[model samples]
Target: MNDELRERIEHEAEKHALLNAVKHDSEADVGAVVGPLMGENPDFREYGDEVPGVVAPVVERVNELDTEGREKRLEVVAPDQLTELESEDETDDRALPDLPNVDEDTDVRMRLAPNPNGPWHIGHARMPAVVGRYKERYDGWMLCRFDDTDPETKRPDLEAYDAILDAIDYLGFEPDEAVRASDRMETYYEHARALIDHGGAYTCSCPAAEFSDLKNNGEACPHRDKDAETTREEFEAMVDGEYAAGEMVLRVRTDIEHKNPALRDWVAFRMIDTPHPREEAGEYRCWPLLDFQSGIDDHLFGITHVIRGIDLQDSAKRQGFLYDYFDWEYPEVLHWGHVQIDAYDVKMSTSTIKALIETGDLDGWDDPRAPTIASLRRRGIRGGAITDAMANLGTSTSNVDLAMSSIYAANRDRIDDATDRAFLVRDGVEKAVINGPETGEPPVHPNHEERGVREIPVEGGVLVEPDDVPPNGQRAWLKGYGSVRHTRDAFEFTGDGIEVVREEDVPVIHWVPADSNHPLRLRTPDGDVEGHAEPGIASYDPDEMVQFERIGFARIDRQEDDRTVAYFAHP
Candidate 1:
């Protein structure tokens, strides 16, 4: 782990230690702090042996402070984490921690800035989802900003601008207005000029390789000490396209000997000769880099809080220099660590997904296999479920692996009652029942009798999964109907034999009558599962969620050629 991540874990451990200290008369138990810290950040769980080493010092430090000092320290580190200390009872840990320093009455403005290169995947959903939750939590306004400035390396697709907004809407957020960085080129230019005049930045003609060598050695560039007037002339010339792409760049002025090489006078703006994908591609050539562009825009747009990934923590430092130059106060920043979805092994990189799509190795963004928001939405995963799962992760700077089961659990509560259950058998084998009922009337849902029963036409020829029948030909219960004995040739069905089914230690299996079964094509993340659905499945309309008894949950997509196409959610 990097020092930054380690530092974050130490901070969390300290917060827990302080809270425990305040709770127990200014002396904290190491056990209390370590348990809660491990719960919040999974990273600590792996390095369990090292946790006590990290926590013992924190516990010692907290015990030195008085009750008042402990409380004050806890408030500074985690403002709203303190519980009501009057009762000395157990405290309720709310699923989502409240955003710190929020004034619910004020117009709290947060933003979702996405580079419009591709549609949002599962990882990208967290930003807008959290922002939307916090927006409602604080009665705040949200802005959808398309960071579409880069046209050469990370080209912006024209469709991705609207695609990202669609994703935000899919997450149940409506940004007050959508803005594009490309549209604010003139504003970026104006600020670049202002920075040169303020003696905060200067144009440098250093070759790219030479600058890298000097920056690595902590040496100043040749044009570092130029007067503001001369820098202004050079900046104007660079902006007016006098400099070819990569010939010159506007660099923010900072300590040349800064400890971090990346922080030493980073490039603010550069010329890109490649035609931008935007309609006004030819109109502008000089584009401000991400740090400079977002620094200026965040102030201009009045964004109060910015939630981004922990990997870009240095961007905030880089933007701070710009903020200092303009004498502007920086917005509150929140960073989250990487989120890995456990269900899919595919990397959640947009560029990687786009390349796979282009190569036809995978389907489009909405493919059942793809982990994009569009894929989930198309598969009938509710927006509320997505947002709730994301909000549950909350704001933690530890690498987390998210299980798809958690998502399924959240969605099950949402769709279980509303969906009707039916019988669906995949890779079915035909069997002749010795005494089968003419019709089977299973309730739409076992939990709700008022929903009524579905009339399924049962006949001698029943279709059941080949695996459901024991190879040893043992007796098994045919669910909702009767007991059956799988023989070498066929199954001998017994009518209403609940006692007989309970007597045998047997598996209860669901079956679709061959005569009444409808063709079904189930699209799942694993792959397509072709099956036969009971006649009851025909009653449900398109986009309706349903449970296939003994199988799993699915959403009815559409009907074509007497076949029902549905998307399988989970088992």
Candidate 2:
């Protein structure tokens, strides 16, 4: 254990001891101090049967002090630390700001519409939490809409649909209803006809290059001037397969001379021959563009709030025209700026990551290197931590690049109080024969006596990491055991009891009985690290998060009869 962690454990134990001492009007009981200390610093509970030995001295020291001295010691511990502990018991009811124009009578509805082309990454995962917070705050309904219309470009994969749903479910946001755009083709066609009938949209037969040149020159295509009836005929002909793909396109009647070229005469629908994976193959050819479909769906689905990334601001602008054409009220749209993680070597793009997965450059969507929600979850990052991190970012419009350290710190704060610790020797392992009692049992958690103990049969040598073994005669501490002197061949136990060495520079390391260890394969973000883990590790369930003594935390992935696989989470 590092000195920092040890100090924290001691500090927490002292606080508990002081509280117990004052409550009983006598010296603090070892059990009273150990229980609350373990509750506060769960990592200490890893000491198992040795928890009593580790905390007994602290309890004895507190007992040696008089009531006045105990009061003085309590004062010495910072007041803020005590306040922090007290605040922890209070519930976190913090919520997002209320939506605009919403009241008891106003129906507040939101939707998380995602293209089912790939698995949801960390970037995609933020929406559900943001929307879910709003949903709870306003008691609104949330819809999970799959925008799987463009099969030619952002092609829909059958597996991706379920994967997206699974990702949303993992985030703990259960949508009130689920809808698919592919299933509502006729609705989009109806809207297209209405637009043509109202002269709000037109069918253009101009060749792609010619229309692009005309639009660039601030001129309209000949087809753009065609009458509503003529445009309707062309649209029907195109939809009936009379026209080959790209021979005609349905363009919403935006200004041809608009400052933004893309905003000028945007394509509402286009012909694509690529077959959709889910819907009947080639049953539909004319696909509605994302903006067109989303606009129609949002209004039709009674969505009152549209929360999405600022990149979709153009989509909202295009949708505004359609809303105006239909004489419908546009939903309140809120766009948040991009969230960038500074630790990522490359900006996380779904399409780029998908290509990497296809090329076998990555293991899968859940590969630790990827920022997918699955990857984070696989690395033992809790969903609550993810939500907390996002909430901390708060709805800021400015693009922010956050450090991975900040994210991991938030996660560590959450899991630290619950996760237990264990011992593992990485790289080359050296055997240390301690000159101590024949057998020992230490509490699995220094603070949690109820977790029971692990038997350490001293007849077998204890396994220690090679780097932790100091030079000859240098004092070192075997955690859960006492102080020892490192020799060339073995660690000579130099203490008679489990007393913590006050020497600040002495290194402390975790150890496992050589005979009671099994081979461990730890999958880290960098690569697989081979090590020897205590036999007790086999009892942990898959996905259980545990801190490796003197190492970082890891998630148990699986355990076969002989070999165990784990994923390194963070330090």
How well is each residue in 1-571 modelled by candidate 2, as lDDT tens digits?
5667667777777887776665445666454455445644668867634454445557767877998787778768755554443454311134355577887898789999988888887877678878877777678899999999988788887888788888777776789999888999989999999999888999888889999999998899888888999889888876776767888899999889988887889899888877777745458888898899999999999999998787878888788889899999999988789888754553488888888888997888888778788888898988766766666665667786655554565576566556777878876466557667655565676546798777666567777767667788786677766677877778787874433443244555677777878888988777788988877788899999887764567899999888789988775
Model 2 lowest lDDT segment of ten: 86-95
- lDDT top scorer: 1
RMSD of each: 13.1, 6.6
In order of listing, the candidates' clash counts read: 0, 16
Question: What's the lDDT for residue 571 in model 2?
Answer: 57
Indicate the residue-level lDDT of 205 in model 1: 89
lDDT of each: 0.78, 0.76
Runs of candidate 2 exceeding 4 Å displacement: 1-95, 344-347, 405-410, 496-500
Ten residues in a row with the worst lDDT in model 1? 85-94
Candidate 2 positional error at 202, Å? 0.7
Give lDDT for model 1.
Answer: 0.78
| Candidate 1 backbone collisions, by pair | none
